[model samples]
Target: MLREYLQALLFIFIAEMGDKTQILAMMFATKYKMSQVLLGVLIGSFLNHGVAVLFGSLIGGMIPANVLQIIAGSAFIFFALWSLKEDDDEDEEEGVRKLGPVFTVAAAFFIGELGDKTQLTAITLSVDAAHPFVILLGTVSGMLLTSGVGIIVGSKIGDKIPELFMKFIAYGLFLVFGSMKLYTSLPEHYINIFSVSGFIVFIVICSAFLIKPIIDKKKKGEKSSYQKAAMTLHDYMNQMKSNFDNICLGENKCGHCEGQNCLVGYTKDMIKEGIEQGTITNPIETDSREVWAKKAFDHAKIVDSLKFTLKYLMDNYKDLQKRDMSNAIRNSLEMALFEETLEFHGDINMYLEHIKEKNPFIMEELRKSL
Candidate 1:
């Protein structure tokens, strides 16, 4: 019983890792608190997987255990192939915001999982299990854990975890476990060298057929000039942000005046005081004001460049499918540019005031700096 439960948990956990629903969870995190998202996931997954397990348990009792294993194994092989298919950008959150955070997430998730791969996986795992309720529990736990990961990736970590890598890992696991099940469940005479080799060749051919399109699409996308430009812009912004944050020597270490008090202003004041006291003759040579001024000017140019690029991308988005600018990536770019604009246009106090309710720590740090 415990073995079956663990198997269900492990299978569901890996299957959910890079799936579209996880991505949706990440997107939802941008709009709601982590705790509310987690609670909704738990409730939604429990209901969805509970129904799936019930259906599968009934099917299990009707069929022979060996037959059920064969079916389950074959289904997993199909799932491995299905994983290569790209997910559609379905607008799952249409008009659901009025339900509040927890209910909105719960409703969205429940609807999303109606015929989703994870729900199908739960049914598959439970079809041969002796304890369907145990499978339900395991699958629900898997969803909660994976949703937490997605939320963390979206809100705190950003693009540190590559979605493509996670997809391949999930695909490989499904393939391996599926093949193992078939090997063990088949008759001993049917699993001889000749048959096994033939099956292996078949799997390889089918996998190649499924994988070739993805590779070809990527290759074709690489030739797009617009794609290259967008990628370059993205990389430049990330590097600039990193550099700006690393140079801070303030108490909050808030990235060269990302807080209320500006380090540039402080440095300028100190330089002025030094000159007035006759301790410094050349302000240019006595302080870093010149360097800071140049950086500020350069930052303005960068912001202007980004605004142009973003506007072009938005206007020509339909014509540039190869650019692969996902909503998450675009949103990240927009937010970064917005914050930079706030800083550059001297509207940071307004921006901070808007965010003060959501992130009180920034206000707290501002007080400390003052």
Candidate 2:
């Protein structure tokens, strides 16, 4: 029993490491808790291997060896096809099952383990009669150890592994095993044709799986380009608003403004003070008082600067086709800066603050576009 136990343990554990059920274990780990999935695998294998050992010899005798091989071979071939057809939870993973996560995992593991090579091997190894139950124990331990590894590793690398590709490799193994069994069981003359045809089909299936992700990414790249452009525009506007806030230094000490108050009126006196502070430039100078006033940053000049910013918004948004978005930004600026009247504060910082509040939605829209 000890020798049988070690043999079963070693053989089944090694066989399972590269099996589809191992991949399934990894997949389940991504959706459910690792502990729960491991428990499910253990329970599922215990039940499956126990039953397989109990009926091993009886089933073998009932069906001739050649017929049994063909039956098992054909079953795995169907399994390969079914595995390929089963969709993975990539792109958008679903929430945990309502059917109780442990039970869901256990049921899936049990179902998937049926007619699998490891289970068949368990049946064969158990035919010795005396230590059938012992063989079952060893196999269960082996399966649990292997499945535990799958669950742990899958949890770590699930995001990086392409779900469809993992399924293909798993299914490919099953297809190869199935075809080999079929080839061995069939008469000699039929071997070459069946072997060649199965090999071609498996190659085609694996190639398709490998290429599908690249094609899908290429398609997504076109849409993401638009999103990238939109995000870039949104980010640029935010940066420009930051530049505007820092455009002047005033007595306010915030570096945003040095005005006496946020509500200070735009006047020639204040403009001359700003010029002396280096916040404003003397664009014109003249002997006449009226001509000197023309160079000042006053109420009219403040309103013109605001209008210029609006035009800037529109110009930058020319490609978006959504003038409403730009208009919304403009409206926020009006509400924040000029809500009561064009009576301006000469301070642009408050205007920048308002735009910041309104600018968040553009980023939200950019995310949705992706």
Candidate 3:
């Protein structure tokens, strides 16, 4: 039993890397919290694979193997269409979108995994295994481990990839995977019209969606300039945090706190090593040099905005950590956005308004931080 569990866990973990479900997790992480997305992946994978294990263990001989294949394949195709169909709307035809981030993610992942390969593979893996429970637990654990990487990496580079392009890639993958599943699941005599045509039509629609945005931008000029600025501000927060900690390290009063992740100590060590080696070539530390001083100073203003935002996160980390970190970080950045000259895009404006209304005290706190 122990061996079975370990094997299932390790096998599924390797299988899920770069899988469509992983991409789905990454997409959600950009807009939702890490914890929320991680929870959803856990529930989604467990439930989906539990059913597979049941089918494999109890009814493997009863059901037609081809029928399961067709069902899984059809599910993938449906999600392909769904990938492009969903917009950035806060409210949709279903209540799932309005149920809040955790529920929304759970629903999305649950639905997304309907015909997923991982679940289908679990069904095969459990077919002759004496330990069904271990199989289920292992599959779930494997998926969570893979999805965790997606969430972390997504958070780091989410802004760099435009949302529409991400959607395009997702939809395309769905079309390919679903089509292949259908093709293999069916008999040699069967033709897959849905898989072939669905992929073609969706590709055309995605092309239109992608092109329309570029065309509109060319005609209107900088329509999303404000939102781009917002993206840039949020993207550089980690770097700014490091730089801010370095400034604190330069102070004579700075002291290391044991057991804590000491940014000050880390910065001091880096600088001292550079001085001793005469090889300090970092952009952030190039200040006091005549050639690089102005560049460093211009960059400081950007970091200043980040400092204000981080102070807000640090001050309210308790209340904010209860919810998604993404929301708290973005809400804090709203303060920086107001001090700028650009206008908010409709989505950001709507988000800011919704957040303020929901967390009145937070909005007030943000204002005071600025």
Candidate 4:
């Protein structure tokens, strides 16, 4: 029993190194209490492993070993393929009710453990051991330890690791396991060729799904850049306003600036200070003090535009982050800054052009200075 327990623990520990359960734990830990999340994961894993052990014992009693091996291998391959095609959006919703850390963590772990490798490992261990309870406890403990580590460490590791690389590793592991099962089941057949062909087909299908989205996003980014570059000052300001308004009034709340104050309010304060401190430089070109005064009075309009743009960025930031578009938030902020600066320059140029037409002497004097 001790030997069987240790073996089950070791196998499960290794198998769950970077599994979806760990990933989910890490993700939940970032938003909820780690203790709560850990509790949830423990409960879920315990239940899952228990079920696997019971099912394995029953099946072991009824089925032939060779047939069971083939079925397990096929299931592993199918799951790997499914994992490769899994969408980030389908996982968990952000900011929905705050489930106490324990409950949330446990729930996430339970859901994630369904038909997972660790569960399968538990089943395998159950078949090998005389006492299934030992296998269940060992596997559950191992899974809990791994998932606890993930929750404690947070999602930083996941952020650093590329999803594609993880997917490839997972596929490779599943393929190896599947081939071993196939070899065991059909010793006389050409199993290597069959396994290799299946792996290739799996890779092709995954590539088709993953590559298309990446290409589409790249194209969309290029188009956005082009549109930004071509926008006039008035149009740019309008866009800024639109972006800000979206942030303030949109359905999603910005994680960074939620509860106390809206981003729109924050931006209005920033603009007000910028104007009072004379840091808010206008793009309009004008030499006359009278024209300068008029533009300065238009500061109200500028404030309104800033509020609109900031709100939009904040709202979109929430959406993008929820969608696992981490870089998108930063990119959108940078784009907003660029458009703001361009609008400022355009306004100054508009004033300067007006001055050049109405007061050629003043324009000539300024041109000479340049």
Candidate 5:
């Protein structure tokens, strides 16, 4: 029993390396707290493996070995095709879901592991080993260990790993496993060297044809979004500059000033007032209104264009946050534009500087841009 459990553990552990379940676990860990995700995976895996072992023990005892081989072989082939068809967008969608950790992890794991290789391995281990309970425990232990490693280490390393390489490796494993199953079903005389070669070629060709275009399109879409974001940021800065120039030139009336107060002078006062009220504790660290005015003017046309562009883009894009564009730009522009507005003209305690500092990225950018 001990030997059987150890072998089962070893087999399952090896089988699970780079498996979809482990990949899904790592993906989940990236967005959710690790402890909650691990717990959910453990619970789901224990249940799935336990059920597989129980059924394997009972079913294996009744089915003829040859029939089982055929069924398993067919299943492996179907799984290989399914893996090729797997949607690459799942990781992105999962990352964005706002579901609580336990539900997210549990749902992802449960869907990911349905008819997965490790589950099949659990059934196989039960049939081969005398001790079904020990086999089940060993399989679960192995899965937990492998998946835990994937969650803890894989999440960090996965970014460095090439997606194409990972996909190829996964596909290769499925092809190998599927071919082996098919070979087992063939009669000894009919199994020729060419059969194995042909099977591998077929698997590779099918996988490449199915997944290559999808991968290419995804890459293209990402590149387009990145370019659009960069252009949008550039244009936004320009619009801010034009607006600043107009305000400072007295084209826009400063409510408190009888046509004498300039926007730049007014902004300087606002910054000073903000610091005094504790709303802006670090005015000295912020970029000067003059520097902001220069950049804003330089990018005026682009900035004007961005107002309309960003509105449409933001309305259509799900994750487009105003903060993500460059909070520093937004804050500086806001301070520059509204400095002369009536609400902030008096000796008000509050200032926009304090609100901007709350965002570290914006604060850092503001300092750098200054």
Candidate 6:
């Protein structure tokens, strides 16, 4: 049982390494919290792989072990060929957003895995196994592991890893396993050197034909929606910095300089006002970076404008991404609301309400972090 579980886990893990479902997880991670995305993946994998294992186990019971091996081997070879195919950049038309983040992700993921290679691999692994339940567990574990890595890579690196390279590795693994199974399962007469050589030649030709388009597409420098979306966020950050649009003062464009009209002065005024209002206490770190953030947040609330707060968040988020900070970008915003020494910036609750009305997706992400 242990051997079966580990084999199934490793097989599915490799099968999904660069699969479209992994890509989907990465794309969703860019816009959602890691915990929410991972939870959704867990739920979806459980439901999808459960059914697959059940079906495969029934089929395995009815067929002879050798026949099942042949079928499994053939399916693996087909998966290798399928790995060369490019995924369509389909947009989500389903109304999953109405159900909230967890359900939205679960629904999308379940739908995506209905006929995905990873799901098929789960079924293949279970088709002749002694323990189908263990296979199901292993496959789910594999999905979670791979999807977790995808989320981390997406959040941290911004698609620096090439999708083509991942696909190549997945394809090679599938092909190797499939060829080995066929070699061992074939009749003694069919296991001759000539037969093996001819089989290799056939696979090589098929692989070249299937892989050519993918190679050509990569050479053409095409970008997926996920990559484009990541680039858009980076571009927004760069544009805001270059134009000094996120500065505290609307007309001041010194870009965080120490000039009289710069953010430092704006922060000084906020600290004074907060102290006068009995909202701030002693031991305040005057030179802390978060002090300016606190001021921007508080000022935005006082004036009933999200402009400064939003800009501050965007700027901070860009810096965090660059530095790979694990802390949330809204730490100062939260402090303004809850910390006694910090002046309560604009109603964080009100800001959440506004965000929900204007952009529910961002609102959902915000609520999750908070």
Highest TM-score among the candidates is held by which one?
6
**What TM-score do all the candidates reach, one by one?**
0.62, 0.43, 0.39, 0.52, 0.53, 0.63
lDDT of 6 by residue, 1-370 (tens): 9998888888778778766777667766655788988898899889999989998988888988888887888888989878777777644415676777777778887888888888888889988888899999899999999888766665455446676676778788888889888878877788888988887898889878877776686676555433533443334333323223333453243244553233435334433433344222322332454444323423334222223334334333433342221112123333333332222233556766755665576556655534
Please write out the lDDT profile of model 3 over residues 149-255, one tens digit for every residue. 65675445533545445455655665676688778877775666775687578767766664575456536533221122123223434443454344442324443
Q: Which is the leading candidate under lDDT?
A: 6
Q: RMSD of each candidate? A: 14.0, 17.2, 13.2, 14.3, 12.5, 12.8
- lDDT for model 1: 0.61
Per-prediction tally of clashes: 0, 3, 0, 24, 7, 1
Q: Which stretches of candidate 2 lie over 4 Å from their true place?
A: 1-37, 52-57, 88-143, 192-195, 198-370
Tens digit per residue, CA lDDT, model 1, 55-142: 9988888998888888888888888877766565545666776898988888888888998878889999988777889999989988
Q: How do the residues 142-258 of candidate 4 rate in per-residue lDDT, one tens digit apiece?
A: 887867765544333433444455456756666677667766776566557776698678767776775566356445432221112122222334454444454453333333433
Pairs with steric clashes in candidate 6? 301-346
lDDT of 2 at 271: 36
How far in Å is the alpha carbon of 262 misplaced in model 6? 15
- Poorest lDDT segment (10 consecutive residues) of candidate 6: 322-331
Off by over 4 Å in 4: 1-20, 90-99, 115-121, 124-131, 152-154, 190-370
* Candidate 1 wrongly placed segments (more than 4 Å): 154-158, 216-304, 307-370
Off by over 4 Å in 3: 1-48, 51-61, 83-142, 162-173, 184-199, 202-370
- Tens-digit per-residue lDDT, 66-178, candidate 5: 76776666555655555455343234335535667876676666666667777776786576457899988888778778778776666445434444444455455555665
Clashing residue pairs in candidate 2 are: 250-258, 251-258, 252-258
Error of 2 at 147 (Å): 3.4
Better of 5 and 6 by lDDT: 6
Ranking by TM-score: 6, 1, 5, 4, 2, 3
lDDT values, one for every candidate: 0.61, 0.54, 0.53, 0.52, 0.54, 0.63
